[model samples]
Target: MTGLGEDVPQTAGAIWRRTVPVWAGLTALLVATLSLAYVPMGRFGIVVSLGIAAAKAGLVVVFFMQLRKPDPLLRLTAFASLIFVAFLLTIIFAEVLTRAPPTRPGTVMPRSAPDMPGLGQRAF
Candidate 1:
């Protein structure tokens, strides 16, 4: 009965633990996000929002979701999707910036309006 209680080890023996630096980095990022919430950045808001979202999403995918593990194809697929989305965004913005809208300056209608012959006024 002398050695009956010696089986338990110290708390450090659990082995499963997260690094302090990672938690610290995440906390800092979170604090930065909170601080940005109070600032009125206007047009810059979209850029800032996307940047922060990307950083936060990267953290979630890399650490929380452990996407860096075995299946490397997932990483490639994600990168490819980002590329395609960026390409699509570029095309949409280009079109929006280059296309001109129809207008009749001072008046409310176009100069060359189409003459529509209603069924009741048309002669065969």
Candidate 2:
């Protein structure tokens, strides 16, 4: 029994049995990520790579960090953090998607531009 009077398994064998599958799942995810990199998906590759990384991170957090254990405050904190991150990412994505594309490739202006009223030389 746990300190909270819960009948959670405290045995080493039970913990090992639970953690081993998580480790194997993480390894499989790593292999999938590496293999996907070789495929020529172009723009979609970024989404796939990020998705795999998020999966691996989730496994590490839930299993290794033991977030699934009976602790309401800890679980609420984790959920709130995830929500905050999602909100931030949504704002960033919206800003990026709505921006206008650059018209010129470089900073230097064209040679045809007139000089300033007082200055005779071109600004370029």
Candidate 3:
């Protein structure tokens, strides 16, 4: 009678089989992200880049962290943490977008000051 807590011995081959595809996918995503940086897409560039990043992060969390296992508590905790992060990002974005633009200088300086009799001219 094996308990749920008992560790199952997995062969190296089994581990490799599961992880190889994930590694390849992550590598592909990395290449895509780097390539996207060079191609200018204006405002949509950030959206696409962030989407790829989120996908990469999801793969890492699910496979590397072994979050795919049937653990209700673990999944719930992960979900809660993601929600908190989303909330924080929303607040930060709101603050940044709502801020006023900086004020520009009223007047530009002249290359040389006008020669006033008492100002620049020194009486010897």
Tens digits of lDDT, candidate 2, 1-124: 5544266667999889988999999999999998998999999999999999999999999887778687788889889999999999999999999866656566454554454344775555
Residue 100 of model 2, lDDT score: 65
Worst 10 residues of 3 by lDDT: 107-116
Pairs with steric clashes in candidate 3? none
- Alpha-carbon runs more than 4 Å astray in model 2: 1-15, 42-47, 98-100, 104-124
TM-score of each: 0.47, 0.61, 0.66
TM-score: which candidate is best?
3
RMSD of each: 12.1, 7.2, 9.1
Local distance difference test, each candidate: 0.69, 0.84, 0.83
lDDT of 3 by residue, 49-91 (tens): 9999999999999998768777778789999999999999999
In terms of lDDT, model 3 sits at 0.83
RMSD of 3: 9.1
**Could you give the candidate ranking by TM-score, starting with the highest?**
3, 2, 1
Look at candidate 3 and tell me the lDDT of residue 74.
79
